[model samples]
Target: MPHVEWRGGTCRVKWWTGETLPNGRKRYESKGGFTDEDLALQHGMDMEYEVRHGVNITNRDGAMPMPEWLDAWYASLDLAHRSMVNYESVIRVHIKPYFSRHTVSEVSIMDHRAFKRHLADVLPSDNSRQSVLAVFSMAMEDAVNAGLRKTSPVERHRRRGKYKKKKRERKKDMPPGAVETLARNAHAVFGPAGYAFMWTMACTGMRPAELYGLTREYCYPSWPGSDLRADPDEADRYAEDMLRYGKGDGLLPAIRVERQVQYKDGGLQFFPPKYESSRTLVVPPFLAEMLERLLKEHESRWVFPSISGGNLRSANFDHKYWRPIADGAKEDEGPRRPGERLALPEVPAFAGKRLYLIRHGAKAWLDEDGHSRFAVESRMGHEVPGVEGVYSSMTVPMERAIMKSQQERWESLPDRLGDAIWG
Candidate 1:
């Protein structure tokens, strides 16, 4: 039993318990006992709080093993299968081996410093550190929520800076001509499968996941209370009619956000788009007609169905197909500047280019064609947070108008800029 005694104006507390700690040594938990009763009482209160609340009395107090706490945290999480897999992967590959034996509450400033140093010194890439930090923060948050610690130690850490390459302004975006040439080449290489996929991405700005998730059931032909174009052949005429009469005196066309498709569970599940606002977009006659054509031609229940008639894997689509096609086209197109000196004389002319160039091309066209940021960001489904989100909704109609105009600009590119990029 621990003992406490007061003598004169001083107080002394002693630990007489014979228990050994994990390191197989006795712990007094105190030394040079308080000379005042008030200080002694406060220490007693702190000790009680530590016992009841599991709060770390000090950073080096040695409460529980890091691996044990991490395991408990993992077991408690109600997360998706993919999310759990990712979390387990990060903990196993990064956190466990380094921190497993360390006591959770006893982890010192030195340990943290070492962790940061290890990340900086030996991490294969900047993203590896970022991923580790993300998992560490999550686990620490769990500790706080469970009342295991007063606050997250992991919260005290931050990445030094964004990756250096990320800090640089991205290269100038590809022009529309280059995008079409690539699309044309993609069509030639993969036939309708590639052409349709590229065109859908270009027109909708939908992510690959969203493209793969598109279900026929979610494709709505008519906006609310809007005229239904039952005949796909007359969609163009119907679009013109709506433009002329849907709004008073044909002054401004009635916005017809005709259809949308969404993916859930990374495209394993399909659903209607949640981002749809009350506002609608005015799609052009050509696009409406194109959609009509696509709907008529494709018999599958998916707009952009997978090769196996299921959702397409994003990696397979990009690597097995997109890269090869883009690289081949780049080879056929020759060097960006004729006889341009390059580091890899042996690398095929197309070896270094990325499929992301298609996305960049669309953005460049949208910006150059005078489309507003609101329009582009909305089309891209970027959820700008806080006040920007409100402003986007208020100004989204102008964005729709700009997008309509941009689409017109895209339609014209294949003819005007065809030779500039392809030749």
Candidate 2:
């Protein structure tokens, strides 16, 4: 039997049993000295009831604390080391600062809504809001799983604030001349390194990270051994290898995208592609020629190797390479011709001028070259009605048509840019 009682100004608990504990002593606990008789008696009675009923009174508070539970939950995730690190960073940076004081049970929907609104207001970038919310939701899910609360306030917040559904509007892709200008500007401003980089991106339509991870083995000539004529089965073997690496076919011949290069722990490393089928993209004739030249000249295995002979990190590429080219390409809209200026239609000052002229560039090229939405979509790796959007399963005819259209548009690029390519 065990009981609680008043002892002086405090409560005392006492228990008695016939059996001994592990120490081989008689089982008896008592509060011999008690100043508050009532509390002592009540405590004694409660202890007696607990012991008689075989109830556990200790360790009820051992339910994990919110912060401790969050830590444990974070550790359990099998995410990429870099991804896990970033998630923890987001918690420390945004979530912990505000929610640290409250237990998991104390957070309500109102609190979550307020936090969301505050984040929306303070964080100007939409992407930042999404990132912060993801971390917040993960932590709240952990709390719910631990039975700290009825439900996660974060789940409610996310459900309520899901992305709005709208008519699927096609993105305005870069105009026909724009990529060529980008290439020319890259060359004129950045020289050989910039030219090659921009040309590769424009021609392949591979994301920057995809290009950065390219290796010599993935490039043409060597794997197939240069002589497209000498080796009868070279192209087929290349195509087969390309398929194993997730390519639809040998459409992108010059350089294939087997993987991506990502920054982890502040260093460049190879990672799986963003999508499951990150395969080879057939290079156009002009770009393939350019790649062949680069491959022949550069001894490094990386097709688009950084100065460090490793994957080109985003920060380094943007600051050291891309920014300089953008800066050098800074040009003012030259003075409008007198006749053209006078011909321009006038509108009320309050009405903002629309940039309808921009769409015309892409539209004109597509129309002139007999390109359909499918062609444009294919070239830009856009999601089709039945496909995963970016990576197509097999569309040889479609891909070829798209490439031909893009080539025409690219060739029609302004001479200013074309002349900038020294070689």
Best by lDDT: 2
lDDT of 2 at 394: 43
Per-residue lDDT tens digits for candidate 1, residues 1-423, read 345678766676654223357998865554335787666766655665565554534333346688888888888887645467678888887788889777776555567668867878868666678778888878877766765566666535356545555433245445445555555554444344445566545555555545565544333243222444544985675665444323233333223333343334555453333343212344444444444455566577665544444445533666655564565533434222223222212213223565554555556656776666766666555666677667654253564565476567567764732233222
Q: What is the lDDT of candidate 2?
A: 0.56
lDDT of 2 by residue, 89-171 (tens): 87777777777666666777889888988888878866788898988887777665654554678644235546776443233
* Model 2: per-residue Cα lDDT at residue 414: 53
Clashes of each: 0, 26
Q: Kindly report which residue stretches of model 1 are placed more than 4 angstroms away from their true locations once superposed.
A: 1-62, 75-85, 120-123, 155-169, 220-267, 271-285, 329-364, 391-400, 414-423
Worst 10 residues of 1 by lDDT: 340-349
